[model samples]
Target chain A: MANAATTIDSPSEATIRERIARHAGAARVPDRFKIIADTSDFFRVDYNDVVVLGERAFWIKGYEKEGRFGLDDELKYWVRRAIDLADGTTTILKLVFHEQFETRIGEVAITCFRSPKKEARILDLVADHPNFMHGRWSRDTAGNIIRILEYIPGRRYDEIIAEYGAGHEEYFHRFFPRVLAEYIELVQAIKFLHDHGEKHGDIRRDHIIRDSERQVNRWIDFDYTYRHGESMFGFDLQGLGNILIFLAGRGDVLVPDLYRDQRQLFDTLWGEDLNISYKNRVANLKKIFPYIPDSLNRVLLHFSRGAELYYETTDQMLEDLATAQAALALHTGRGS
Target chain B: MSTQTFGDLSRRDVERHLLVAVDESENSKRTVMYLADFFGGLKDVFITLLTIIPEPSEDFFPTEAARAKWLRDRRAVMEQAMAGYREILRAVGLEDHQIESRIVIRPCASIGAAILEEQEKRRCCIVVVGRRGISHSEEFVFGSTSNHILHHAKNSAVLVVE
Candidate 1:
């Protein structure tokens, strides 16, 4: 039983609304944007909103916030999507939203933060690089960055692997070599960033979009950064390893999933064969799939329990991968 | 001063100089103790206590004042720590002139690289550092500063005191 005129509301609803309004004021593009309508949930505007940047007007269409389920309220509110009214092309609009977090890899704890300006700087640096998403940015009256990134059309490599139909054996023999080659190219692109004293910060399977039209694997999302220290690119390097495991295993092949699907293959795996960081997951794929060469398995072992030495740079990884490629070539020749 | 040539060390006219890189960690204190045990009361040995304070990137802080405050606080802490280290070396019979204390505040990507650069500039025969005590997994992912110094230091003998 409540008062007749009293509208029920959460305790923090008013606070959230106030905070959002403050952020929205800072992110205002002034004469460039017109708010057509408002979304019921997070985003600032609804469908078909008009945003004028310089001489171009983009119509807000759809959004692609991948971590919608996990993202905090503050983060979800800043990201947006729009389509170019003149060219009929889509673009991702990222507004400034600051967040900092501490993460550890083994014993080393690192402080990472979100920096929209840094991402804009990276975009400018790699503007012509084919393997990276292209974007241009401008600052608002409050000095908050507003980036308009070209929405590259393609499916994520993770989804591509998840929907792949061929069995592991067939895929390994028929297409794994090509996958390896493409991965090398991807690593080279990362090396380019490293050479320029920059880090991708976030490197995941889904962040890699395979643009079939461009025939390139383009990396997106560069807003994350960490305090530079002994392990400057540790997060990115680890992320690359995870992606390799996913692609090589033909998707995430968890221990329980493998046991349920193929008891024989699961039986072949030992505790040491699993990833030390992720003990429940298989790392030594050569144990289950014997066709996986020892050289490549050794590289994978860098992320597993059997590792003697880990890669310090992309150059070392590339060198080891080249050796694996040579071995694969010899094996293929023998099979022919 | 007596010019003594240690085993396999090239003959030199000047006194032997050692560059000891230190921070405010317990491991650094241990390294200082180890140096006192070995090189203490050796009047000919010159020790340069070097501490490199990496200036925080501008993007790391919300404002210029915050970044400046961080740098100032870091410099103050390191300066005090360096003074204590200097006192310990001085008590061990090393003259005040023989021990040179340097605190570098600059944008550095790698502390190991900065140490190596200082070693090259100062022409120190030996570079000493406390082992960072990183686990195998940590070493694999983040890399070891001591390991980097060990492999990359040129024209200077590296001593990683554990």
Candidate 2:
């Protein structure tokens, strides 16, 4: 069976369409296409399926597995990988999916939604810029906006951190400086977007990929948008804090679990040091890791429940981050 | 022992509630004019003018006094506009009891979502908004309030007046 499929030439669009109709319900039909997932019948592309948009057709290779690209699980239903038949290059295909929901931070209620159209706009603005995913979009027969992004091969930043296999104390001294340098670059990239009047609505540890070829962090996914006009970039600011906490703490330090298992570390932390949105997660790392300088710990406090002030803009944050970096240089003589 | 049925039409059953979301823009005045020309002098229809003032969090400003002063100034301006809108409806033969004005001061992420919440709370059957003449590029990137309402408002008929 493998030999027979391998011998066959790349099928035409018409032939591929017929195979899709023939194997409508069947799963794993040899070399034929199978609809691996369907979302409310709005989008139904799957492994081995051919997606035609405009004059170009892309042959589906497989669905991008969750955590592989740090792709959010919620977005998995609409995102897949394919081989661009024209150029024989790989691409990431993002299908149109509508999702809107609300969340609350203290007294403020925020409405967040998925916007493929906005992402397409952002791609155009950052087409030539490094440290951003490159892509273009087109409408399908159903009027659904389909985005084809050139694939960036690399491990997610979180995946790299997890593979480091070092204790927090060792990682802090040996590798934390390198992470901070990369984070500074990431901040500049975000600043570029802000300068262009765009926001990377979804910023997380997994969304940043350490490109194996370029050897730099490249941010992916800018489709999430939240309604907060008072501070237009408020959501992205909070996202930056979350990444800092994740990177500094070496991962999430669940306070409740710590209290139950390791009472000593839990006893050191105050209730006010917890994240404003996630009450059980610790935000102030200095209480546990005394090695963390006061300069840097002060920045993390802005995202905590006991915060007296909040970051208003990226420029403001970069100023404080510079001070923190200077203090780190004094101690370790590494990242000055 | 008493069975008296006289067409079974109560005041509540005959009333049609409309929630019109407005701002200080000139387009909002046109919306009011359109409403007056279409549904004016209708005894059974009730209109509620809603103006949402998104109050930023205390931390958003440099000082508490700054935040307080900003809120006070914003409320004053919006209250004046709401009063004017209320008068426009009253002039069209909508009785004092039939016209209601609401100025909400709260931390709202989306004005469109906030308006829909009030619509659901007041059990309004129709929602009215003024088109802002937003360009396609601007609407594609920033999203417009009217578009958000037209897409997300549930169980209510939405009307957008230019």
Candidate 3:
């Protein structure tokens, strides 16, 4: 296997030696990438680095550039301060920078460290999401000062979802259930955010990570998250429905049989005519899954009702899913 | 947890000691200086710089053989970092007898936890690290590792130098 360290350009043997010597000198090198200090027991310097103090661990990130503009420094500061206050156990630090001339876009290098208590929390979360992949970050002192952390690994969920296509039952069988579960989870998570007076303005597959092993899912990239009042219900509902429709199938294919049922339920609650769009979505689902079973279609149709009629609150939909799961269990002798 | 107390001793009374950590950034020189200040000198301090080799991702390449080759290439880079750390120590006047260093390859998510585990097993008294400077906004959005260590260094004192 290729060594993980080999891919990146770290300090070289001679460079490290030179750095040590330079640090010992009174006149310091002004290069953006030069080392600043080297002593008997510790080493300190800048390397496109950022420090995040978490409740559980301290995360140090290293980047390749100096600084950037257009980035929300204020937001970053607030988030760091908030994490420091929310809990005292885990911390995250990131290193990012843009080119000297091109200050609009920048690159990111992140490191995460946790205390024992926070470490346990991370371990448990990772364990639950076995499919989730990450990079290794830590401190190493064999000869010189070094810290390492793992970067996020694997293909993004959106890429995988796009590859599979929305209509393929095989794809749906493998990922749809998880996607549905994620939608529900997102609703709940968003509710939590809302209760806390936060609004995740941007909610999409790119923001959510999926782990296949322990069936774990998480939302990230809160850069666009915001705070809005309860009056934002219309926005939230529109976004939710759009995401569901997008995930279920976009064009003329068979909408998941379960979702068809959900549409009817949604209509009942909202007292709105969604027949045109519903029919189009069902057609799209059929095209996606040509051989979908009639019985499954019935179930999907039933489930669609929840989307149309009963989903005034996120909980209402969750409760309906639970009831449906129990009924399905009695019918098929299988429980999720 | 059982706390083992050792009688207070002068700096001269303490024997040889080693500090192990990784240089995630290219600024090992700065990190080294911070360590020197933290521990008083490089005379009795043996620093070991190490890096972990992560498992190759499935998308590393198109074929298994290609992926394997890519991994091999990556390993070479990690080895180079290890060598660099060794050279840095030598330039600072740390003899082989005083400092022993190597790079380790392992697949794990939490590198900080691993370092602490090794420190406890080795019974080290201090851990010296370099601090990453991040904007206040980013820090609040994402937590930091150095901050975590600052709060939880129960057995060993963590000296975070910028």
Which stretches of candidate 2 lie above 4 Å from their native place? A1-42, A65-75, A104-109, B1-162
lDDT (Cα, tens digit) per residue for candidate 1, span B8-69: 13433255889999998888888988998898898788788899998876767767898899
Best by DockQ: 1
Stronger candidate by lDDT (2 vs 3): 2
Question: Model 2, range B106-162, lDDT digits (tens) per residue?
Answer: 776678889999988777889999998853323322347897798789988999998
lDDT of 3 by residue, B1-162 (tens): 111222212331254444556554655557765554454435656555545454543322324686588668877876766676666666656665555555555543334555666555556677665666854322322334466456555577776767
- For residue A274, what is the lDDT in candidate 3? 25
List fnat per candidate, in order: 0.48, 0.02, 0.00
How does residue A41 of candidate 2 score in lDDT? Answer: 45
> Residue A234 CA error for candidate 2 (Å)?
0.8
Candidate 3: which docking quality band? incorrect
DockQ of each: 0.43, 0.03, 0.01
Residue B134 CA error for candidate 1 (Å)? 1.3
Task: In angstroms, give how far residue A27 of model 1 lies from its true place.
Answer: 27
Error of 2 at A268 (Å): 3.0
Worst 10 residues of 2 chain A by lDDT: A1-10
- Over A261-321, each residue of candidate 1 has an lDDT whose tens digit, in order, gives 9889898887777775566778888877788889988888877766777676788888998
TM-score of 3: 0.33
Name the docking class for model 2: incorrect
